[model samples]
Target: MRYLFLLFMLFTFQLNAQVVADDFEGFGTIYSWYGDDCIVDANFLNPYQQGINVSNTVLEYHDIGGQYANVQFDIDTTYDLTMNNSFSLNVYVPSSGLTGSEINQISLKLQDKNIEFPWMTQSEIVKPIVLDQWQTITFDFENDFYINLDSNSLPPIERTDFNRVVIQVNGENNDDEVLAYLDDVLYFDTVSNNPIYDNLVWFDEFDGNGPVDASKWFKQTQLIAGDSWANGELQHYTNRQDNSFLDNGSLKIVAKGETYNDQDVTKDYTSARLNSKFAFQYGRVEVRAKLPSIAGTWPAIWLLGKNINEDGGYWDAAGFGNTSWPLCGEIDIMEPNVAKNQILATWHWDNGSGYQINSNSVPSTNANTSQNWHIYTLEWSEDTMKIYMDDTLVNQMDSVNPFNQEYYILLNVAMGGSLGGDIQPGFNQDAMEIDYVRVYQETPLSVQHFEKNKVSFYPNPVQNKLHIDTHQFANTNTKVQITDLSGRIISKKQYAENGDTLIYNTSALNVGVYFMTLSFDNGINQTFKFIKQ
Candidate 1:
């Protein structure tokens, strides 16, 4: 047995040694990527300039009254890239038509094979000018995050091979007059040698036809107070395309103030809410998203109990499990209050019984939570729950109180709620975009026996109370304790002279895995695994 154990240890170490590189460095030549024209060959693009009244050059400076300009390039053919790895690109925009308040739109995109556009941060890649000369534009694909690329959404990429690249003018802003310039678009290598994460189990690239996958998600459409949400929330959610759309390899949940269905009442708000029906007990959950920045916007990524309705009550109704306001646990993995530009991770739970339970919150370490896209994640185990912002563990719960139940995922941009209060006047209507939500499960490790005694328990996976027979050690002083997998002690009791058997009332325990330990005065200990139903 010792020899076999040593062999297993050696194999585990070898597996951990195999590191996969995430960062990639691209070659420095632009000519190496172009086929014939000075134009860079890419996966997809729509430089509107070729349409009628637009410029194709990277250097142009006239906004046509009703005209526009754009440039498109495909990166798929430029490098052999994997969604599991990171890649970088270089872009040069020597000058852009920027007056005091005029924000000219220039963008970087990771397009699907169809050449549809999903613009990156600032909605317009900003280029600070030095002089009137050509400036070296450096775009690191890995450094500057774009639309999320998942296992299935990333277009086929190759070395010096690309599908498309595009640059466009904001026809709504420019009087068909502002001109933008670009040059030296290149792809390079990344720096990741070993991934901190690889245990992905499920995800939706939102690449197929339809309103997300119905089997994986459910859409809610009960307009609250003339809007689909309450708390004076701004966006009026609808199934209509104007408020929500699935195009260009993304699921766009736009919040606008347009007339659709039969409501002519205008206050400026339209959006969409998508919920996950697949409940999970304990695992890692992550979402890569670009949040909306409107003043009244209350965007959030959170979780809800799966059996919330088992008690015969609606979500917001009165006494339902712990849902009794602060008791019925709420895990807010990511929430951006807009005006603050800060991200918050919080937890709310009912302390066994109360009008309001205890709650905690922590600000994220990253700056400008709503300006750029970011990956927000939560790690939940048997005894503890942790929240991670961009690879940093910020907040954690380890009291072993009562958070060991199944929970489903929820993502939405509420206008107003108990948290955001209500939408104020003059709020912009923009979408809270989501790239994708992914789940991963870690491999369980083998157990090593510590100490043992003759004390025994029977009929595990019990439906009612449990009984422990201490007939084997009649004179030993034994203390009993029950703890969950996360190492949170749930219940503890002491026993005197061990004669026949002792009974434990477990009517209040939830259905899940648990551990029971019995310690004697002589330092002897015995542990047993059990389940409660």
Candidate 2:
């Protein structure tokens, strides 16, 4: 009976897989729906509950005489207008509750939320609303007439940059009062079959003790500007092992309240900054780390464009520097402001005219960032970039021109910068501990295809040794990692100059399900699930 019920549930889910952006009755996929220059109650009781759509709760939008009043929301994923170009909503406007002589119409606008002024590059569709009646309105961007606020902007169907939705009852820039109710807001789209990024391109497990791997990282100690670093930071970065080291299978970046001198200058604090030797374009970066507990410590795991013309940088020293930043772009995956108890993810770039930035912050109290280990991730693609904390989406933005190139990773802990407020009077030292940093990119073949066509392993349910055949991957280094079902790493081994077959011992593992991932240096990976019995 249980199996039969599971099969029936799967069948029902497949039949109704259409994406519902939001519905006031509760199953809304978007959570950040809010108001701009207006007052809104997303879970208000239906005032006039007698119509074809008599839902219990609906979105109450009250434009209390504010100019440019509207209700807006941002989604973690952009609307792929190529496949789903239509949106439908049910709206009700009471003529008695309105005081404006404006036209009785509702406008649906799609915008790129990362820009300074989103409406400047927006695509909009206006529909007339009937007073004292609930009307169902549909805006079909592919078929209906749409107006692009920016004449140079592409058509809605040809763009993947619309991640924000704005609904306004009347025209903007007027002190007109309006009262409206909205329900069943949805964007229809077929089930997506997009490719998954499972191939491991690059990683640093930070194994062993002492200094970091020189081949994979460069300690950046050079002071920027004349006396201090950017953002009024008080730390003087040093190359010494005391500030940065590996211990007990983790990387520790220590920040100390001590007077240090570098480049003929002295500072009251010292820390370490490490730049990754490897650089890549679009991919997924995951870092499992714990932040510092000190009130003034600012720990960051970020990325910078490889072409940044900063002095003493790894890429700049290698003669790849040309553009100055923010022209070169910056992506801050995770930066904790200890004083404010918030974690920020920001993007900086040159928007042709000047420097532009888009940022989002999450309260650290919810995640206990300084007291617990969390996985911070940045999923980057040609269309969008999404930041995640412990697998929960925190911020997302559409990709711009500056983010289409290669970027290198950076790990540092700064003291008392612009974001990191005042330090504790008795502050001594604190450290940010990192377990691992891994980068994954998409491969030509899927996981099933790669495992079936290129590699093979025997004894799916084995008691001890398991043998893997890798004749297709010769004369290259491969990293093998084994983990339990809970994603806890069990063991890791490196095979350099390996032969056709490799043996992995599983005698120590208890009887359970485990996963083994084979990561090749040539930017490919395959995972196999097996039983240890």
Candidate 3:
């Protein structure tokens, strides 16, 4: 049943959306990739295949002490950055292959390849890299900090002259020898013209000052392991009002430096962990939150599969427990590493072999999460899942296997965990305040009804033919049109004198969602949605 649903989703939503700029797999839209003052092997075999990227082929860049060593690709058409401004790539830089003491960093620059001197007008975003492992990094011109080589140049989103992407390792002008492996270079515009998720289904506004709504949230206070939680966290999650409560119209999950004992275990710090009672298949989740800034604090807004066989989870208590941890899937919408001042979004699942994770990290929008409130969003659909920070896309991955199942939400703050290194001395208390959490799903298609005209249609999920009856207004001239979800017209016709029935041959239409409209000469129009199977 699940596999059939997955196939249905793929057939219904698959459209011509070009997001992968290059992956070196013979399927990328871009065909012109070259190097500037460097050596590039476009069809090199993968040397390290254990980490995030494990493709058979990759792009190997070797900068043998060139002054301006980089790899670049050019497109024939200039990009409208205001619409499509997000780009990402997976990079692996090994310390054994590097020669100089330059900082370990990768920079992605956008330039006008047609210009005589592209470097003078280039805009670049630099990200620090790890030495031995593969890491996926995103460059969001609309969100990340960028530098324009020419001071007089406008911001990346305001310009429309970018036709080339240049990727450089370490500082370019220095005589530093660096070797890096790159794959899955992607570019996309997060905005959707025909959004499926538009109807709000569930929400929590944290209205009054008191305990959280019992019917909507469950406090998971039971200890999972022997004496501590997973990941070496020092916090004992409790249901006490001091730990989780509503104050001043906001939900506050507080962590304090106090000795707490629960379930025969004692911890020096205490916090709250909440599991939303609601579980959903696929939808859009929006959370407006202000994070805790203490060095030892790890605050997260995440989701876990409803079938996860966790003892203390809300869904588990409700008899939906079966699958294990990574196989059940995990989606981390927002997790803040306070020490690094960065926000990480990740997806974990089993890819028929072992645990696989796809992740991306971006610097906090304001460099201080506690000082500002930001809206973190997760847009999940049949084909893809996207995570956004204040409307700027930070991460995107294909929807597969475990992600097709239902999942519930989890919000918590842990202290001194694996990701959170050490506790700050004399830290008393800190709170993560959340304004609201809202979930939205796609609106179902309405029943076709035209009262005055008395129009009707058959074969909604049409394969090759559609039949419509419009004999009630026989004397009136009407126009019929069919369009795709993006408002691109597909077919149009005019009926001079209305007949008893009209037939449309839809064999040429693609297998996706489309709209059909009927417009009469009397200024009356009606539209209905249909699917071409």
lDDT at residue 473 of model 1 (Cα atoms): 47
Q: Residue 249 in model 1: shift from native, Å? A: 3.2
What are the models' TM-scores? Answer: 0.43, 0.56, 0.61
Better of 2 and 3 by TM-score: 3
lDDT of 1 at 255: 65
lDDT of 1: 0.50
Report the lDDT tens digits of candidate 2 across residue range 99-180. 9599788999999999899999999987667799876777767645467888788878899889899999988989989999
Top candidate (lDDT) = 3
Model 3 stretches astray by more than 4 angstroms: 1-110, 114-158, 165-194, 365-367, 446-533
- Write model 3 residue lDDT over 1-533, tens digit each, in one string: 01111111101112354333566665466677799988999889989874546566789999999999999998877876665667877899989989979878899999997889998999998877778998777787865657788968988999989988999999777998999999867675433222467789999999989999999999998887777788989999999999999999999999999988788878899999999999998889999999988889889999999999888888998999999989999999999765757899999999576887878877785657788889999998765788988865667776888899899999999999777779999889998999999999876641122223455666655668877666544687778888665546889988776565667789998665556777778886655545565
Please provide, for model 1 over 400-435, each residue's C-alpha lDDT reduced to its tens digit, 9 standing for 90 to 100.
Answer: 434677677877766655555556675557666677
TM-score, candidate number 1: 0.43
Query: Highest TM-score, which number?
Result: 3
Task: Choose 1 or 2, whichever is better by TM-score.
Answer: 2
Candidate 3, residue 262: the lDDT equals 84
